[model samples]
Target: MQIELLVFIVMLGAFLLGNFLLKLPVSISMIMGAVLGALVAGEGFPLRHLFEGTFVYIDTILIISTAMIFMKVIEKSGAMEALNVTIVKRFHKIPAVMLIMLMLMIMFPGMITGSSTAAVLSAGSIVAPVLLLMGIPAPQTGAILAIGSIMGMAAPPVNIPAMLIAGGVDMPYIGFEGPLLFLTIPGAIFTVLFIGMRYCKNLNYDEIIKNLNFNMNAKHGFKLYLPILTVLTLMVLTRVLPTAIPNLGMPLIFMLGSIVGMFTGEKLDFISTVKDAMNTTVPVLGKLMGVGMFIQIMTLTGVRGYIVISCLGLSTVLLYVAIATVMPAFGAVSSYGAASVLGVPFLLALLSGNQIIVAAALSFICSLGDLMPPTALAGNYAAQIVNERYFKVLRYCLIPFTACIIFGIICLIYSKNLSFLV
Candidate 1:
């Protein structure tokens, strides 16, 4: 094997050894990989590069921190409880409406940030209790949140995976919204509907309604969600109405929302909530830091280039199986990493057809990495929020995961008919 590819093998081995044998935290395992890569690069510990690599995703780190604070504030302020009670009562009889609304609510954060962890930890944390109360098993709850969050990340306006693939091939991010939406929406609807039908009959509406914990005496019942509304409105104004409002990025917007939220009903401990948010973000931040180092090394050593060239020689039949397997399985590391490493090569290999279908199909496959094992960030985090084993969550995730891959493959095989996708 080439030196780059050999180093990559050592990196994976070190990572696994650290995680399973040494019993380190997940971030430390990733850091172990980076350390191995750096040593293999013969740089003798490049301190500056290691430090710089940690901050490569500072924006995403900030978003995760602030969004968790927003969620915690709502929890402390009683807004979350109030909103859930109202939603439960409103959708009590209609299981479909309950399922769809809950999924959409869980998905809202991902829609804005294009980050699955954000969706799961923030909105997923809020809805998880309700799902549990409705008798959805913990694994199923985690799976539902994870599936919904991935759908949101794959959808229009802020799809990071699609953006990565599109940017890789010099395709405009615009005009892709339609095709990507088609890739995600149907799967999302099916996931929620199936879960709801399976579990909704167990919901004890009367007990849930009777136990409303928050004092709902505020004249503006809907306005209690102003903090959340503010964040959403700011995100919309920044992206959709750029001329009218300065684009205060996600972290700042979430901070402002948290501050505004204290005025809603109950007083909140700003410092405590922020600290809690920070605590919640610790693992994610460290993972990013470690992963960043590995990615930096990958870019520097040209392992990504080697993989691209190697994969191009596969037949079309093998190509489909490879794409379906690698993108999601390797996603156990990071979907964005998988996208950057393999997306362009796959896109190039499959270029005998329409760009839109190929791009969406590639994104769809990459998006599945959100649920893939090891570092399946979305499902793992959802498991954390819902207090369940991450692997158990993966068990419930199999059906939706299978469905998404099937849809993606069909899109690829029939790309000719999908010219309308453009």
Candidate 2:
């Protein structure tokens, strides 16, 4: 076998051994893989390359760090809770609408942080009891949360996997909002409607209201929502009036929003909240760093080029099948890992299509890795919130999971037709 292929196998094997056998953090496993791959390729320690790889995603890391802090701010300041309560109060009369809205609420954090764990832990916790109060079973509630969180992780503004894939190919992380929204919004709506709509048809508004803590909305009213609005408005203005309004990058936007959150709703210890947010964000950041190292080594050893060249030989149908299966299956390790290792190659193989649309679709599929077994970050946490086994949540997610794969493949196949989105 070629040295590049051997190095690739060594890296992948090492990652699996470390992650499944040794039970290392996915980030560390990836780092182990990178180290092993470098040794196999006779690259010595390659410390300089490894360190360079860590900085490959520095911009994305900044976005995630600031966005997590922003998420923590809204969550701690009661802005998130207030919004949940307000959604329930306004839409309780319409179960379908309410379920969709709640799913969106569950998606909000992941949308910002590009980490499904954040959404599952923060918004999923807030929405779980409400779904239970609506008579949705624990398993189905967990499924809804899991699916919504993954979809959120794939959404616009901060989709790390998409960003990684784009970065891998040296593509700009721009013009993705349209394709991402197209994929995730409908996917999120379908998950909630399919999993929770039947149970939520007759929601108990009085009971839900009694259980919901809406003190922020009650005390602060419209002002409680200002931070969220500021972030949204700034994101839009930067896009809409790029020439007039300086395009504050996502990191700055999130930081500005976080600062606004400090004073908008509840009083919070800025230092403590920032520390907590950073603490929660470190693992994900590590994963990004590891993926960077892994991919950097892959590139240095010619493994990345080998994979792309190998993918170029596949039939379109086989390529689709690979994406539908291999990407998510590998995601069982780490979605970021799957994106950097597989997603980048797949994107290159499909370069005949609209690059932006194809990258967006590929990222959507990679995001589903968060639902894969053993290390189902979103699924595990979502199940915990609903007091259900992760497998039970996976069982409920089978249909939506399959649907997302089919939808993503369709997006890939028709990417050229969808170029208008870019």
Candidate 3:
């Protein structure tokens, strides 16, 4: 028990120091925590253990890296820019139609990219000016971007973290695609629309018209759509298609897409593209390495087991609250942090076949941290683009976020296949 308490304190101290004192990214902080925990726990900071643990996260790094490269190639090719232009021109005359379409456009990329920042940076630039000109307040515009971008993160193909957690639970990766689309997609759409509609209610038609006139010309043409198509096709082939064809995974799909994207256009500069892709890939790998180390350290110190056991003793409602509150702290540090620290052990404990209610409840609640404040990176990026305060956007998100958590818990309770802990 003393060892467990010491480990817990060391882990928490590392988290605080990294997040507040050092101002390091949450993933780095997690790595720090793991290293510190290993040292303090008398494991003597084994280099081999750290290296092996870092190797475990390579899969995650590869997925994010390739996806980032693919996105960068798409962006540079001017395909994304053209798509934005097309969207704005088509919807310029109809505010309500434009809003819905824009929401979908942002959401689609997020689903594919799995990076809320990518979603906003890709879609928000185009949409921001339109909203600004239309008389939408900066805060409201930010709220729209934040909410729409979040919807994308919760969607399919690109939600790698969700896939990882689901995979950890012994659930097939593809199996979760269906549940996410059916349950989480609606939840995301409703959440975005709810916030958007409330803000849109007071706007005048003239104000909306004014926003429509702000430059709809594409810097480039629809030729760029090819890369986007390549990504989508690869996603379908790897995620939706059967393994009967042979080896297919997200990394291979991205590599193929990058190759195709390079040759498809007039320039055909494969060498530079690959180099650029590598540059983007490295930092992402570093981040995942840190996260993986954190998970390894937690396992070493036994805090994960303690937390799971402690959670098991709580009632369902209390369990939900505990998870919801604690997850944000980890999540704020890094999504991967939440995944490693809470997700792995939580899943392990729940999978004991004795705590399905709590397992499902925790899984559902964990996703909400992506939108929670202080470290709500998704919301922060959206706010930056639209010029809204972070807290304001978070306030609008409160209800929908809460609802999803509640619905997820109820789903777990009612799921016939899930066993309850009591």
Candidate 4:
């Protein structure tokens, strides 16, 4: 028991230190801590083998890293830039229509890329300029981009969090598609409408549209768009098509996209693109590796089991609140971590018929981490593109964030008797 506690403390401390002080990615910190914990618990303290086992979550990590590489290659090829500029130009005639169309455009890259950062960086570079040229405040532009990116995460294919959880739960790879389409899509649409309508209500739509810059070099040949379009089509097909078609998984498709992107243009250089993609891929993969290690260490140390037992002791209502609140905190730090720690147990609890309400409640609350301050990765990316403070951007996001949480809670309450739907 003492050794287990020590392992937990050391691992947790290392994770925090790496994240906050050393400025290292959380995954690296987690790996270091896990290694240390395993040594300490297995030898010195002699607790039930801290590394009771290892699961090759590294495969998932590789898949994600390759996806990032694919996105980086596409971004470097200027395909994303072209897509953004094209969308803006095509919709310049109507500001409201432009906003809606831009929302969809952003969603496309975001869903395929799996990195909200990439999505915002690519989309915002174009959208922010248009928003600014139209006399929109930086804060407002930041808000729009941040909120739109959040909505995009709820879309198909590249939703990493949803994918992780669904995979962990052994549901169909795309099982959440139906629920997300039914729930998050409508929720996102309304959220966009409400926010966009509120922001643009006072603006002169004609004037905004007239002043927009419709011409730019952010154009690409049809070939560059093909890979992205193909990927998007596959994603949609995965949702609707039969499972036996040997559907290309998202990671491989992305890798193929990168290859296609490299040859699509006169300026495109395959070697440089591959190298550039690797530069981005390495760090991302390292971090993911570290996260997997951390999760493994936690499992070995029995801390995760302790957490589960503790939660199980609580009444269903209290458990719901506790999990709803705590999961968001972990998610705020790392969505992957949240999925591993909170998501796994939440799923287990639900399967066991204990804290089922809380388990369901977490599906929504966990998303808040993506929008919260400090580590609000998605929001920060948006802010970076528009040159605004991450927290300031987060402030504007609170409205939609709150709405998602409230809706999730309502779902939890109602889902108690609707297990079939869940």
**Best-fitting candidate, measured by lDDT?**
2
Ranking by lDDT: 2, 1, 3, 4
User: Residue 152 lDDT in model 3?
Assistant: 70
lDDT, candidate 3, 273-315, per-residue tens? 6577567446445666876676667667777677667766777
Off by over 4 Å in 3: 91-97, 198-222, 238-244, 263-284, 348-364, 417-422
lDDT of 1 at 116: 84
Q: Across residues 230-315, which tens digit of lDDT does each residue of candidate 1 receive? A: 98788667867888888787678878988888888677778988788678667756776776676666666676677777788888
lDDT of 4: 0.63
User: What lDDT does each candidate get?
Assistant: 0.78, 0.92, 0.64, 0.63
- Which residue segments of model 1 deviate by more than 4 Å? 109-122, 132-139, 152-181, 201-204, 214-220, 347-364, 374-393, 411-422
Q: Please list the residue runs of candidate 2 whose C-alpha ends up more than 4 Å from where it truly belongs after superposition.
A: none
Report the lDDT tens digits of candidate 2 across residue range 1-422. 99998999999999999999999998899999999999989999999999999999999999999999999998998988888898889999999988889999999999999999999999999988889998999999999999999999999888999998998888999999999999999999988998877776666788888898867887888877888999999999999999999988999999999999988888999899999999999999999899899989999999999989998899988988999999999889889888888898899898899999999999999999999888999999998998888998899999999999999999999999998988
What lDDT tens digits, residue by residue, belong to model 4 across residues 94-149? 65676677676666555655555656766656667766665566776777777666
Candidate 2, lDDT over the whole model: 0.92
Worst 10-residue lDDT window, candidate 3: 213-222
Clashing pairs in 2: none
* Residue 205 lDDT (model 1): 83
Total backbone collisions for each predicted model: 0, 0, 0, 0
Q: Model 1: how far is 264 from its true place, Å?
A: 1.8
